[model samples]
Target: MGHQTETHVWDEELAPEPRGRTWRPEAGCPVEVALAAVSGRWTTLLLRELMGGPRGFTELRTLFPDLSAKVLSERLRTLRERGLVAVERRRGFPVRTRYELTRAGEALRVLLVELYATGEELLRLTTASETRDERSPGRLEA
Candidate 1:
């Protein structure tokens, strides 16, 4: 993935996504950001499953026990619209469909892995801090 070096132009007139906020790059081009759209509850789970390889809708449903078929369909449609996934028909006696990540989506896998690692480290630190806090005595009010 090529990083934007110079300041790419931004349109102040453009409307934000569902939420009323725009993403301004810290030091790069104002390319359309992908985080907000795919950073929700079941989004990462969906992406993680796709990382193993393309799978059919039924297969996806099986992986996420709690997710309803309706919700899965919605998420997949959203991902497709965002260019994060490609949906194609599978040729068979009975026609079926499958979903797979796009190049940009695959790149996001690396970022997700890094985020997972960071989350684990934070949890460990939090647990340690809690243990220390529990053992330490607090001051009494005068």
Candidate 2:
């Protein structure tokens, strides 16, 4: 005797009403939405690079040599899905594609600049603290 598996069918009458677009952050939480859009490794760096203007895939890959092509492609797709980046393809002897930041993406430039500034400040503070610790009488340099 052969074992039989049962398949379940979804019935509209039994199904719950679709909750439309629940992933969107509530209107009051703009920061949440912004963070959600850029929440991934190298996402900010990709945005920062795009701020300079449109760049080919090869150009972007060269900028971050350590990043694998797969991750970069994924990041670009995510940015596109979020409406932050637009891709343009030029047909020629050698097909060329370039990505440019949309207005929304350009708007993130200021935020990125502020973040860089904050990072610099944090680095300064950390280095100063390390120097102080090294000079303190009770501490031994590692």
Candidate 3:
């Protein structure tokens, strides 16, 4: 019988395909790769912004005032290395540089949208539960 999960049923056992025994986060792991691509503060926001169109460093920094310039640069560099973002340097008086999502990055659009929806649902449920608990005196506080 397959291993049972909330959202999936493994045909045999839930294990890494290539790593037969130990599953660890490394370049060879696809799950790790996906998580690494999107794991960082302001990363999803950057990708979301790029979804609309290409943007320059100053433009992104201006849009997100709270995000520091150093952090922004680091995130962009990581994204570029991950092959999720393409950097275009337009030689001019000021040397304009633009950042846009690559094909792989664009593929994450659905994932981001779904993540937002899931988060909203979780928040809604939590709020409703909290409101009920506050109003109900019979509710036990544990």
- The C-alpha RMSD in Å for every predicted model, in order, reads 9.7, 12.9, 5.5
After superposition, the stretches of candidate 1 with alpha carbons farther than 4 Å from their true spots are: 1-34, 91-94, 139-142
Provide the TM-score for each candidate, comma-separated: 0.72, 0.70, 0.78
- Taking the tens digit of each residue's C-alpha lDDT, what string does model 3 give over 111-134? 889889999999999999889889
What is the C-alpha lDDT profile of model 2 across 1-142, one tens digit per residue?
A: 9998755554555333333223455544555566776789999999989999999999999999999999999999999998999999899958888999999899888878888899999999999998888788977656
Cα lDDT, all candidates: 0.78, 0.85, 0.86
Q: Which is better, 1 or 3, measured by TM-score?
A: 3
Per-residue lDDT of 1-142 in model 1, one digit per residue for the tens? Answer: 9896957454555543323233554322223354554566799899988988999998998899899998899899888887889999979868899999999778778778987999999999999988887787993435
**Model 3 alpha-carbon miss at residue 123, Å:** 0.5
lDDT of 2: 0.85
Q: Judge candidate 2 at residue 66 and give its lDDT.
A: 100
| Top candidate by TM-score | 3
Query: Going through the candidates in order, what is the number of backbone clashes in each?
Result: 0, 0, 0
TM-score of 2: 0.70
Best by lDDT: 3
How do all the candidates rank in terms of TM-score, highest first? 3, 1, 2
Better of 2 and 3 by lDDT: 3
